[model samples]
Every structure is written in structure tokens, then in C-alpha cells.
Target: MSENNCIQYINCHCYMTIQSLQIKARMFSRISLISLIMIPVIWSQDWQVQYSSMMKCALKGSNTHLSGSYKHPNHLTMIKTFWIVNPVKGEETINLVDHPDYKGRVQYSQNKDGIFFLSLSNVTHKDEGMYCLRIVAKEDKYLFFPGIDLKVTELRVEIPEEAVEGKSSILFCKTTCHLSDKTNFTWFKNSKRLSESNVSDQLLLPSVSTDDTGNYSCAVTDHKHLSSPAVTLSVRYPPKSVSVSISPSEIVEGDSVTLICSSDSNPPALNFSWFKENQSSAVGCGQSFIISSFNSSHSGRYYCEAQNKYGSQRSASVSLTSAGDQKAVLYAAAAIGAMLICICIFIVVKKNIRKTGDAGGQSGVSKQEENNSTAVTDQTSAKPPKPADLNESVYASITHSRPREQQRDGDEDEVQYATVQHHRNTRNTTAEDGCQNGNSVSAGSNTEKADDSNVIYSSIKSS
Candidate 1:
């Protein structure tokens, strides 16, 4: 009995396999039959009491049944039968029904064919023992040697001593006795089922974190109400989701400033570090850093690191500035704006100047025209223009006083001629383009030729 589990026995520290235990169940016993009113041991053939099994295991808080069959000689009448536990070889003991320890928890059934069954309900660790059957016939008794061994076990949620975050760990639902491979195990967390038969032996927890902390328990599938005692699952590591906040969001020169770091972790993070945007090393270390008087040297983006026994994490960066630096930035922006405005105004003024120069050239041309008109007025003649046709006829009449006798000869018909100064016609030229020329027509109705003494008359008309 050394190859199997044996924690159920109080004195025995070893266990035997089912095959070996069954062989052991058939131990030698002195069983005899006797007639009524004649108490004497009568040798008889060996009795046959066969059990379904000799070694049995069950989960705590569950029930187990032990069944067996018996055969005896035809001459004896069966009186009574019962079951006992951890009994002496020949000494009589209390049956399971009357035993103080098994009150209200034991049941027995027997058929007329000499077969019987023993049922143990709500089995517990204290109930672990060797059980045997007894039969009484005509005041003589017999003890069935060897017996069934019963063991009770429960599930446990087992974990490693140092479970860490972001790491894998296997948690076992264990029992001291090995149940059949077909037996199913159930896992629970805070009264909620996590898995069934598929993950009965162990639960694989990956990337453990603080959020995974909780109470865990397990039970055999059929004995679900008898779940194992709750075991707490805790995960530990460095800080996470680290972040920094700057008090008084707007920074000003000579103003006090504070940077505070925060994170989520188990057992709390105790170390912290502050760093500038481009610097390779930390500027300070603690939960918070304070600057009594801000300046340009501290005006840069910064972040912090949070650390614990497990590891460390860095926070998001923030920026800081002084009042003087802010004002300088504003001044430079204003100067650029003013310079752009001036350039735009200059371009507009240049365009207007070009337009004025073009208009002035047109006015100058009009003034030159006025000057030409005035010159023409100064030299214009006061007479209208004469007809310009050369074919127009000029007629003249002349008279001559004849001597006494020549008068009688008709000399009065002598021809007369006169000179004419011609003027241009207005129909063709307005006095030589809008002004009269100095030349004029000067002929009188009765004019004397400079070479003739007698007066002559002439007139000109366009035909």
C-alpha cells in the first residue's frame, strides 16, 4: 500500500493501488454457521463477499456508495447485517448507523439475494477509515475481512509567491488525491465562473496587473456547492500611466511654480525624477519640484519618472515660460505686422501716382490746343471770304467824253477794266481753318483805274 495516496488513514502512511487493495480485501477470516438453540461452531464452506472496489476517493462534501455481494450455505437463515469501520478482527463494533460520528449520514440496503450496498453522505476528512461488513445468523456472527478504504480531498487555488505584472503565471486547482481523468473541475472569481472542464487543472493568467487582483476559489464539478476556501490574488509591479501636472498653468517671471507627478501602482511608487525636454539627466527627484522664481533657464518642456521596487515609467511633457520672454515674443510679432502694413500702403500710393501722370499728359495736350486758337484770333481779318471760283465773271461800265464831232461817232461804248483782290470761300475753308486770313476783297462800285481818269464800276458773283 505504498504506491498510491494514503492521507485518509490515521495510522497508515502508505496507499495501495486498486488492484492490490482488492486482493487485500480478501483476507482470511473464521466464519461459521450454527443451528438455533445449539451454539456450536460448525465448519462450513468459505463465504463469498465480493466488493465493487477496495480503494475509493471522493471530493469533500460529496457522497460515496460501497456495494458488495455475499453467498452463504443454504442451511443458515440470515438474521441481520450491518457495516462497521476500523474494526478488530473478532471483536464486535458499532454499526455505521448507530456510530456517534456518522449519525444521520449513513444508509444501508440489502436484497434477498445476499447483496448489500453502503452509502456515506456528506463525506468529510474525519470520515476517512477502513470499512467492513458483518452478518449474523442464529446467534453466530461472521466478519468480512479486509475492507474498503475511503479518502476525501478538496480543491485549492495555488499561485506563486511573487506574482508580477506583465508576466504569465499558472494557477492550479489542486487536490491531494488524483481523481479520474474524466472528472471536471470548476474555477471561480468573486463568485463568478471563469472556466469549466477545459481549464480545470490550471488557469493561465497573462500580463497580470493590479486590475486582476481579486478573490479566487475552485470546486469539483459535481460538488460545486463545496467550493474551496477563497484565496486572494494580488499582482505587483512598477507605476503605470504616469503623468505630470504644473500648478498655475500660466508661467510668469519671478512667480513660484510646482510640478507634481502621479501614477497607478501596487504598494505605491516612492521615487520620482524630473527632466527637461533636451537634457540627458534628471533635474530633480521627488513627488514634486518647486521653483521659487521662474526664469529663462527653466522655460522648457519637462516630464517626470515614477519608480518602485519593480520598475519605472515616465510622464508626458509640459512647457514653462517667463513673463519677459512672453512679452518679447509679442513685440516681435507686432513689428512684423507693422512692416507688412507699410509695404502695402507704399504699393497703393505708387499706383495712384502713375494714374495722375497719365491724366496730366492729356491736360497738357489741351493747353497747347488753346494756345493755337489764341494765335489765330490775333491775326484774323474783319471781312467775310469771297467766292473762290475762278470762272466767276467781273463786269465793269465806263463812259468817255468825246470831242464835239467824235461824240457824234459813238465812242461812248469804250471797255473799262479793274483789279480784284480774291478771298477764299467759307464753304471750302473757314478763313484758312477757323480764322480769317489777312487778305480781303477791296473793289468799289464806282472805282477809277490808276491809269484811267474816268470812274468804272465792277461786280463779281459765283455762277
Candidate 2:
């Protein structure tokens, strides 16, 4: 061979070696990647099987199961031959074949892929124990899985023995199972859900009252399990909405009255008292106060108080009045009216008497004038009588009894005269005066006309 041909052969040989190295390297990389992926999968399956051996908690009177498995793809031919159950305390070991008594309660199944499961129906506290599984292969070899512990749990609620009305209270929800942080709690009152959202395990009440008294229960949202039974909360409180009720609302004096004190309380009211307006002390003590004969003394604003061991409350005040007082006021008003009427009558009578006296005086004066006009008087008239001596004077008796004649005289001017009797001096026709002559005389005089005058006199001498 020539030098170039030898060089070409050497290049071809080197190219073939390089190509073979590349192919081998690529294959090795593919295999390494596949191996890396398989190692983790295998490791995860082993981890799951090992983790399944840990203790498990389940609620009593509920269905539960224990599961076991061998390495994933490699153990495809593996089969669960039997199941063993170990109880917590006694030497009672249970197997699938030997425990005929547990045939109905215990269930076992193994998948074609080597996944094994054991289920217990209506699990009770007595079923708490460790469970183990046995795997059998076609090689006549057996693989014993680690034991798994089974724990029975129960839900319970804890609350205070007693709660006070208008006071804060707390209730707690608990369970025997180990709960995760994501677990949510729910509360129910009288079998009614309080809220739709998840809440804390503890229930807090800012204030409680008689309305809050009911059956309360709690449950876990994740487990969909409730507490065994509901608990009843008792709220103790004082009297509330106190009031006083009176029978025969329309009251009258001298009538019997009944008063009742009413209040709402938890334990019931032990004492009741009645009070009147403006008084600080109670007037009576009892749930019912009776007034045998109500009178003005009982007419006033009244209220009642109800009390118990916890506290006391006062009722609204009510007013009462007697009818006798109204009647008395009316009678007094009538008496005052009568006295006023009498006073008015006296004033009217006094005014009338004064008017009558003035009229009578005027009438009496007119009557006296009329009597004088009808009267007639006669007396001896001596015209121009000189001074007469006592011996020469003569006295005569004169009388006129006809009043009609005196009035009939057309020229007569009626003159009224009183009768006079006198003795005059002899020188004087009139005899001067009776007293001067020292003689008693009677005389009368009347004038019929302006120029005519008639006078009459009568005289008597003293012995």
C-alpha cells in the first residue's frame, strides 16, 4: 500500500472508533437517566410501605382499614397470604384462617399489583391493637411486613358546670385522635349549625342568658364526625322584666285590692316586696300583697321588687286613687255655692228697704196737705178791735163742723186754723192775748175770701 492509502485507512479506523464511543456514551447516558428515575420511584414505594406501619387513630364504632405493600414494580408477583391481628392487652392473637369469630367483622383483600388491605367493621375500643400482613411468593418464600398499631378514638365536649347570666363563658371541643393543623371545628346548638365557616376548637361566648341555655355540640370538619352527645348549658341569673299586676284595675275606697309581683328568673324568685312613692322602705313582703280594705292611705304610686340569691329587680311604678276623695270634694263645692247664694239675697233685700222708706215719707207729706185742705175751722173775728178793757171784752163760743160747706164757698180761700180760747183786755176787742188777760180762751178762724174772715172764740175764767 501507498503512504496516502495507509493514512486514509488509519482515518477510517479512527472515525469508526470515535463513532462507537459516541454511541456507547449516548446509551450509557440513557441508561443512567432511566436508573436515576427508577431509584427514586423504588425508594418512594418502600417509604410508603414503611410509613404505613406507624400507629393510626380511628373513632370507635366507625369503619377503619390497615394497608401494606411491597416494592412497586418489582413486587408485582407478591400476594398477601394471610393477615394477623394483635390485641392491646390480652394474648388474643387473631389470624384470617384461625379467627372464625371475626369472620364477619374483619375483611381482607389483596390486589394483583401486591397492594394489600385489611378492613374492620364496626370497630370498637376492644379492637385497638397492632395489625401485620404476610406476603407469599411463587418461590415458596414469605415476607413478613412490619406491624401497624390501631388506636380507637372518641369525641368529647368540655364545658363549665354552670354559667352565670350576662357573663362570658367558654366551651372546648376535644378528640382522642391526633388531628392535623388544617382541621376545622364546627359548633351546633340544639342540632342547628351556628356558622358555615370553620372556627377554632374553643367556643367563646361574650355573654350568656336564658336564651343561650340549650343542647350544644361540636364536630370536626375534616373528619365529618360529631361529639358523642350534646351537652346542656345551665344559666343562672337574677330576676328580669319585673312587673306588678293589680287585679280589679279600677280601685275604690273601702274595696279589697290584690297585687301580684311578677318576674322572670332562672332559679325563681324567693322574695317579693311592695313599696309606695316617696318611701324608701317596703310596705309589704310577698308575691301577692292584699289590702283588705283599700282607702285613701293606699292611694299613691306603688311598685314591687323581686329578689333571689343572684340579684334583685324593681318593677315599674303604678298610681292608684280612691273614689271617696272625689265625692268629698264635690260636696264641699256645693256647700260653698249655697253660702254664696245667701249672701247675694241679703244684698238685694237691703237695697229694696231703703227705696221703700223714701217713698213712704213723700206719701205721708201729701196726705197731711190733703187733710188740711178739707178741714174747716171757726173763730170770732173782730176787725180792728181797739184795745179793749178786760170788763168790756166779751167771749163767745164758735164751731164749724161742715167741711163740705167750707170747701163749697167759691170765694173762700181755704185756711187751716187751730182752735184758740183766750181772754182779752176791755180796751182791746181781741182781749189782747189770753195769757195777758189771765183767762183761758178758745178761738177758731177761717177765711172764705181774701176780704172775708170769720173768727170764733170761746173763753173761760179761772176761779
Candidate 3:
């Protein structure tokens, strides 16, 4: 036949074979419209005779009833039969049992019922795939049944390695499906289930701490199925018991101050820094910090911070002012200035009194001297051309009482003359004419003489 006629013939044969198999399948089993079908129909005509053989078989579950069909126009005989499995698309291919004795052979059987027994132990996921029942006859073809789909359930959990103390933390356990649907969920801490509610997707520790640290796992089961790969939760925080204080609760200019930062932490702080308001400055990791000569520049809202492997924490800010020193200095200066002024005033008053006293004393001395000189002149004039003896007698008594009486006398001539006579007589008279003769002078004369001398001397001194 021509190529076209031959192609038409093969097509006709394949269509008739499929139609016959469908009719037979309908009569044998009650299948749904969506049920898959596999049929064997040969297209080549190489005229050969072979024995039928079973090459591979894949059965799902415990049911080993394998059902498929193949057709051949030529006579064939049954030979050795062996089981094998089809290769998967994305996984490694395993070599199933092969039957060399049944190679290039065909199979013929009177048993039309499609059922075969297979070992249940040999059934596995790797054995799952499209399986074929090969029949070597006048034409070689295969009866195929698509492999069954296998599903696996795995349990997975996610949680943070570290958590802040006293903070609510969540431990999540996720699965392919809801635990209530087909599986039971059991949360474990150190291998103890903590499932009390329907919430199996998460395990909650309202407040977490280092004491809560341990290996955590979820026991997820679907009937007899179980999963592995538990999770570990390491509850940790940056630190606790953070504290801060300011040295010299009172601050002043030109004074050294410090800020102390301390805390209880594991994996001690690595970065210690200071901040004023929002501005940050690098600092050493110490409990106390010293800032020499604190000033207004150092005055502001101050704070400290500590950091560790977990995280960082900041202390409350303390406000500082450096105006104290300025105020103190101003007060001291005012006090000193007042003291100095008082000292100066005292010194001035004392000096003025001494000068006044000295002037008064000098004036008095000069007045006395003048009075004595004036008295001498007067006495010399009054004595006249009398005898030196008489003059001496009068002057002698005058000189004796003049010193006592001169200060009381107010007359200038009498006092001056008497003073002169007194000096002359003291020089002229001898001590032998003492009391008796001196008393002979008049009391009025003596008194008047002394008063005049005092007045003249005082007047001259005053001028």
C-alpha cells in the first residue's frame, strides 16, 4: 500500500482498538467519566512472534489488583514476568527488577480478570510512578496506568533566638494544615506538651526570661504520622537593673563632675556612650565618668547608655547647671568690697583727730611764750629810773606769784609788765628775800597782772 494508505490504516486500527477497550472497560467496571484510561495499540507491522512478559508493576495501598489491556492481531505466547516501576520526573531513578528471560517476548493469558498479587513491603514512594504491562506479540505495545500521587506532612516551627525580658514573646509552630483538621499538635518545652487550647499554631510565653530558655518542639501527628526537626528558643534580653546617677548633685563652674552608668547584663556592654539631649558622644565603658572643670557648655540634659550583644538601653536624662560658682564669687566680692570701705573710713577719721590735737597743743605753747615776752617789755618800761634795788624788790615778789596768777588775769599791760618783772626779779633777786617780801606786793595787783598776761598771750596766739 502507499504511504498515505498505510498511515490511514494505522490510524483506523488505533481508533478501533481504543473503542473496543473502552467498551470492554465499561462492561468490566463502573468507572466515572473522569476516570483515566490506558490502552496498547501497535502502529508498526514488522511481522514477528514473541512471548508476553510482565516488565513492571506499581500498586498503591494494599490493593494489588492491577487492571490494564493490550491488543495484537498476531498470535503470541506467555513467557517469564517480572515487576518494575516507572521513573519520576525530578527525582533519582532506581532500577527495578528486570526479567532477561522474558525480554523480546509476548504474553497470552486466558485469565481476563485484571488482578495480581504483589508484596506489600516492596511498595514505597520510589516505586510509585507510571507502571506498564508489556505484551510482546506480532506488535509491541504497553498498557499504562499513571502513578498515584503521594503526600507527606512535615512540621516546622519558627521562633526568635532572643527575647526581651518581661515582654510577651510568641513561639510559632506551623504545619501544612490545621492541627485540628487531621493532626494533633503538642507544644513542648524540654519535651513536655503545653497544648491546652485549640491554638496549636503558636505557643505563647506572656513574659519571657532567661529561665524560659530551652529546646522547644512540636509533636504534630496525623493518626500514626509524625514529624521531626524541633526548634530551640533562647530567651534573652540586653540587660536589667539599669541605673544612673550624677556626681556632685550640686554643679558649678570649674568643678569636675561625672555621670555613672551601670546595669546587670550578660555578655557585658560593648559600647558605652553619653548623650546630651539627642546629641551622642562616644564614652568608655565605665561606671563613672569624669568631666574636668564643668561649665555651662557641659550643662544640659545629660544621660548615659549601655549596649551589649542583645541590644542597647538609655538612662534617664539629668539636667545640670553651672551658675552656682558665678553667684558665689559675686557674693564674696561684694563682702570684701564692703569690708575694705569700712577700713578706709576708720583710718581717715583717726588721722584727722591726731592732726587736730597736735595743732591745739602747738597753739597753746606759742601763746605762753608770747605772753612771757610781752610781760618783760612792760615791766622794763614801768620800772623807770627808780633805784635798781627798789625795782628788784617789786619784781622779786611779782615773779614769785606771777606763774600762778597770769592765766587768770585779763589786762594786757599789767599782765605783760608783771610777766617781765617776774622774769627780771627771778634773775635779779636772791633766794634770801623769799616769802616775807614777796607777800608785801598787793593781791589785786598780782591778780590783775596774772589775768592780763593770760589774755594777751591767748589773743596773740589766736591771731
TM-score winner? 1
Clashes of each: 2, 28, 21
Per-residue CA lDDT of model 2 for 2-39, tens digit only, reads 99999999999999999999999999977754543341
lDDT of 3 by residue, 268-289 (tens): 7766777678665554446677
TM-score of each: 0.56, 0.49, 0.31
**What does candidate 1's lDDT look like per residue over 276-313, in tens digits?**
98899989999999998988788899899999999999
lDDT of 3 at 162: 61
Q: What's the lDDT for all of these models?
A: 0.72, 0.69, 0.54
**Error at 244, model 2, angstroms:** 0.6
Give, for candidate 1, the lowest lDDT window spanning 10 residues.
33-42
Task: Report the candidate with higher TM-score, 1 versus 2.
Answer: 1
Error of 3 at 160 (Å): 5.3
Cα error, residue 356 of model 1, in Å, equals: 20
- Quote the lDDT for 371 in model 1: 67
Local distance difference test, candidate 2: 0.69
